[model samples]
Target: MYERVEEMIQGYIWKDLGVKVIEAVDGEVTLHMPVKTRQTQFHGNVHGGVLATLADMSMAAAVNTLVEEKEFTVTAEIKVNYLRPAAGDFLEAKGKVIKRGRTLSHCQAEVFDDSGKQVCFVVATFYMFKKE
Candidate 1:
C-alpha cells in the first residue's frame, strides 16, 4: 500500500518539489527532499514553506494508512515550529499518527537535516472523508 501511495505521489505537485517517500508503514511515513538552491531562501537555508510542505505530506501519508480504501484525508489544521535553520544536502520528515478517530486523525512530524539535527516540528489534524 505504501509503495502504491508513493507512486501516486509522483503524479502530484509533491513530485515537482522533489518530495519522495522513503519509508512507510501502518500509521507512519518518512519523506525525503533533496535541498536545492531553488528551494532555499536568500540566506541559503531551506525555506520554511518547504519544511511545512514536507511535514504536511508526511502526515497525510501517515493518515492515509489508517483510512479505509474508499476514504481519503485532508488537512484540517497544521502547526509548525521552526526549531532551527535548515541547511543541508537533504531533509527528511518523519510522521506518525498519534490518534485516529472516525473522522479525524491527529499526527505529528519532525523535520531533520542530513546531519540528523531537528529543524522543525509539526502537529496536524486531518479529516477523513469517503469518496462519492
Candidate 2:
C-alpha cells in the first residue's frame, strides 16, 4: 500500500513545502518539513498556518495509506494545539491513524522540533470518498 501511494504523494504541496517522507507504512507516517524563514510570522516563529498545513498534510498522508485506487481522503476538520513556538531548521510530524470507519477516519499527529521536543499536536477527521 505504501509503495502504491508513494507514486502519487509528490503533489504540489509536497514539492513546494519541502516535505520529506521519513517513514510511511502501516497506517502511520513520519514526515520532515524543512523550515524556511519565509514560513515565519511577525514574531519570527513558525507561522500557525504553516504548522497547520504540516499537521493537516501529515494526517492526510497517514489516511492515504489506507485508501484504495480511486479512493482518497479529505480533511473534514482539524484541531491543532500549538505547544510551543517552533524554532528550528526543520520540523518532523508523526501521524497515525487512530480509528478508521467506512466514510471517515480519525487521526492524530505530533510535530517535533529538531531537538525532539514536541511543538504541536493535532487531531483530525478526514472524509473518505471514491472518485466516480
Candidate 3:
C-alpha cells in the first residue's frame, strides 16, 4: 500500500516540489524533500512558508491514500508552529490523518531536518472535492 502511494506522489503533477513519499502506515505518511538554495528565505534557512507547503502537501497525500477515488483535496486551513531553523542536508515531513470524513479530513504534519531534529509542526484541514 505504501509503495503504491509513494509511486503516486513521485508522479505528482508538481514535480519541482521535490516531494518523495517514503512510508505510510496506519494513516501516517513520511515524505522527504531535497533542500535547495531556492527553498531558503532571507535567513539562509528553509522558509517557513515552504515548510508549511510541504506539510500541507504531505497531509493531503496521506489522506488521499485512504480515499476511494482520486479526489482533489485542497488545503482549507493550516496552522504551523516553527520549532527550529531548517538548515540541513534534507528535510523530512511526516503526516497523519487525525480524522477522516467523506468530504473533509483533519491532519497533522511534522517536519524535521536531516539531523533528525524537529523543525516545524502543522495542523491542517483538507476539503476533498469530486473529480470532474
- Pairs clashing in candidate 1? none
Ranking of candidates on lDDT, top first: 1, 2, 3
Best by lDDT: 1
How do the residues 1-132 of candidate 3 rate in per-residue lDDT, one tens digit apiece? 654365566665437877776877767888899998988989899999889888887887788777755466778889999999999878999999999888889999999999999999999988977875
Report the Cα lDDT for residue 28, model 2.
90
lDDT of each: 0.89, 0.88, 0.83
- TM for every model, in the order presented, reads 0.93, 0.94, 0.86
Quote the lDDT for 45 in model 3.
Answer: 99
Which TM-score value belongs to model 3?
Answer: 0.86
The residue-level lDDT of candidate 3 at 10 comes to 64
RMSD (Å) per prediction: 1.4, 1.4, 2.4
